[model samples]
Target chain A: MSKVSFSEEASVEVVTESFADTPDPRLKHILTSLVEHLHAFVKDIEPTEAEWEQAIGFLTATGHLCDDTRQEFVLLSDVLGVSMLVDAINNRKSVAATDTTVLGPFHMVESPPRDLGANISLDGNGEPCVFAGQVRSSDGTPLAGARVDVWQANGAGYYDVQQPDVQPERNLRGLFETDERGRFWLRTVVPRYYPIPDDGPVGRLLTATKRHPNRPAHIHVIAEAPGHASLTTHVFVEGSPYLDSDTVFGVKESLIRPVTNVDDPARAEHYGIANPFRLIEFDIILDPVRP
Target chain B: MSKVSFSEEASVEVVTESFADTPDPRLKHILTSLVEHLHAFVKDIEPTEAEWEQAIGFLTATGHLCDDTRQEFVLLSDVLGVSMLVDAINNRKSVAATDTTVLGPFHMVESPPRDLGANISLDGNGEPCVFAGQVRSSDGTPLAGARVDVWQANGAGYYDVQQPDVQPERNLRGLFETDERGRFWLRTVVPRYYPIPDDGPVGRLLTATKRHPNRPAHIHVIAEAPGHASLTTHVFVEGSPYLDSDTVFGVKESLIRPVTNVDDPARAEHYGIANPFRLIEFDIILDPVRP
Candidate 1:
């Protein structure tokens, strides 16, 4: 019975009052916040009717472009930095833990399980490199048997799903188990920086805003171990374009790993690769699960 | 070159800087404000990744529901009161002028022009009523030759478009010009308060919130004159269910007109209606166009 007519000054209150009977308290909270912020945005923008219509059209177009393979709304969220913000908010671990970034849209397929030193580049795409990482607890104790899931775009910046005919199935994807010393190493092509699938409404937004659509070159990782929190993040390749200006705003200063050329035959042989192998090494630390 | 890593504390600045190169200043201003407000909302909600995904899915479903005849997003806008706020901001006139409301979605077809006092209820749906109103300027001068466009839902709370097979085309819709004395009258059925298209995601949202989707019974109006700004509004039928709880927040106290049972034979004869008819009289005043 809390029926109150709408007014400009009481807009937020009125709209929020409509949601008073939500069964879920959390849903009520989120809807209330959304209405308040949404109304505030509309009031601040004071959009003309034409402008408002244009926005609805934009969103509808964005939705229309989304399907199983293409997620235009996710792209919209990514380009607007909401995806990264959500990542940041959800992965708020201690400083001792490795920093996190967005798990981009390319992880649609699970990485096939492979031996620790197996090469994942089925088609030998991009520049060959050794991607070796150590998983550990926040206390630096090696987390043996930790799961390391990896996926990335090929040299030309396209994932297997994006180029079904051109790229071999799971061209640059793998799942691995860390050894007793908590180390995992495998062969992969150095991911090249590329524009997100931007031929759609989100791309139009980037173009309209004079923004670039390219994300920095990066490797995707989702690590998990018993008694430790699961972490989904990326290891950025240093010096890649758009590292600082990733279209998805997924770059973390600590997550950027340098691609170093190692002359050590011992290191290369250990990874079962040729001498003087190009290497990108990163280590991950996961926070212990709280009680 | 405003490349900066995304962080919770710097999310707003980093995102706004990305749109700094937008050529259109208005777009830039709007995007800047939008990003600021949007990021603030995300931060406030601190949605889990799952919650964020749910929102994206909701929007995608809302988009998928949109077609030539269905605008689920507009319904979303209306239910959240954004439509009314936009109308309020755009139609900020002096109190002497008429209060404005949302132009509901049924005004798709052009209302056919009819002479004053014509019967718009071709189907004879609902309870027969006489609707009369005068178009005047803010200074109280009758505005002759004002083009008044009118449309409304029928008794069962459905428009002709919703029931094409049952109702005739252009049923209960009309366009008439104000006479020299600024008087206009029409024969129509009293509109019944009805639910919005509640079979979609927005309807589910209302159901989830325990909010009924019915709007107060009302007739849509768009009056335009030579030197006055055109207005899109509604004259709400008083005593109708949901008048105070119009789901779209389109109700204004001044815009509510009672459907009086007037027993004036002479007046009814002048209007060519029954002696004892249901008369809903509403007057509209437009604001002059700014120089």
Candidate 2:
């Protein structure tokens, strides 16, 4: 009995009922709840008509802005701390292992391979230091030949991804294997802390929310061995200004460490650096994930 | 000592005694766990460099798309089924009441007020029908003076918001208060099913995923009374096409009903309609929210 001739607002009950055949019970359940909450949220907020149009326009632009290189939305999530929240609820690392942080939006490519003793810094201008670390199981047994992937921003806190033309592709990024004793050592510059890209809608959100976009100075590392839960972590500089307020909420106390300057001639000779250089040790422990 | 000056291809261990002074134990715990899972997910996904960049760009655009009225990202979440999942986990409705669905982005502004028996249609060329509904507590107690806000698409399957220049402001939308007997009535046309806006990144995602953007034809309704939880729901026409494939995933069986034509002169006299007219009824029951 279809009546298609008069003009008036139709009934909601009839309209809602007509879509009974949608597949996916999960989808149905989710959509129904979303409608309820979203409607409630709108009623609660009660924005003006103009404001509503502005929101729509903003979303339209957001869709238009997407492309192969930019991910403004994820950055927004990172800056707003939602990403961190999701990660926190999911990771739940055991005690004793070093904590982890945000992988950031820049780790988009494969790192170059290198030997255990090799240096990853292509630019020689920054301060030199030797970083030695052991990859061990949660019970302190070292795992030899563990693969360690590392990347960092330059002294100015810019990654190669951020400056593809200026910085050589994969600069300061490398993949290396651990030594027989489950130890790895390499030389690199002290990375400078940097702010996230502030050139998109996420930047606008940051400005609107009065939140900073800087992450503390840190080096990102991912350690892995077969059967072990891969550890994605960072080593934060002890005094970095943004440590307490990493825009992505990535900084953790267990991941922060101080870089000690050592003038020991023997240690300097062993690593082939001049006397009085920076030294820091980062030990990583990984739990066994069910195979 | 800092002894490593790595070349572009060399790998180095950067000692990090960082994160020594980070406060906020909760923050530290969260950041650490997030780092672990995020890195793991990335490694697991193993997206190509180009794919990774594209994802980043998609997220960036999603962020840019947010504003006051439209939430493209939320829509994205809806299409991806994340929004519904969140809704289901949070809103575990019982079997008696009408189910929920995704609240579309169009409900941005407050609806215009109308008398209980007033028509909300500005266009007189569409379907003619009378909609009657009752409001009650979840236990079926009548709720006198309850409010019912309603809106719908026009004969062309377009909302007033979608055709501002053609449709009068607030066309097909109305807010009505229930009578002393907790009953409300209105006159209007049955709206046809239509497609969601498909000119954005979310549209692109749908296209790439080979999904249609069509939503089942339906009317939107929200009923509220003091001391009772507000109910936002929709009414689907029984036989409307696209009921099985609403792009926004908003369909509940309890919401579907047929509007049958009636030739009773007495009812036509009461509603001031012609002898042959259409009618549909829906009784909404809302639970009480604890203070």
Q: Which candidate gets the maximum lDDT versus the true structure?
A: 1
B-chain TM-scores per prediction: 0.97, 0.83
Q: What is the TM-score of each candidate against the true structure?
A: 0.97, 0.57
Highest-scoring model, TM-score: 1
lDDT of 1 by residue, B178-265 (tens): 9999988999999999999999999999999999999889999999999999988899888898887888888888888899999999
lDDT accuracy of residue A260 in candidate 2:
93
- Superposed by TM-score, candidate 1 places the C-alpha of residue B278 at a distance from the truth, in angstroms, of 1.9
Model 2 has fnat of 0.07
So what's the TM-score on candidate 1? 0.97
* TM-score, chain B, predicted structure 2: 0.83
DockQ of each: 0.70, 0.07
As a whole number from 0 to 100, the lDDT of residue B192 in candidate 2 is 87
Model 2, position B213, has a per-residue lDDT of 80
Error of 1 at B283 (Å): 1.4
Candidate 1 DockQ score? 0.70
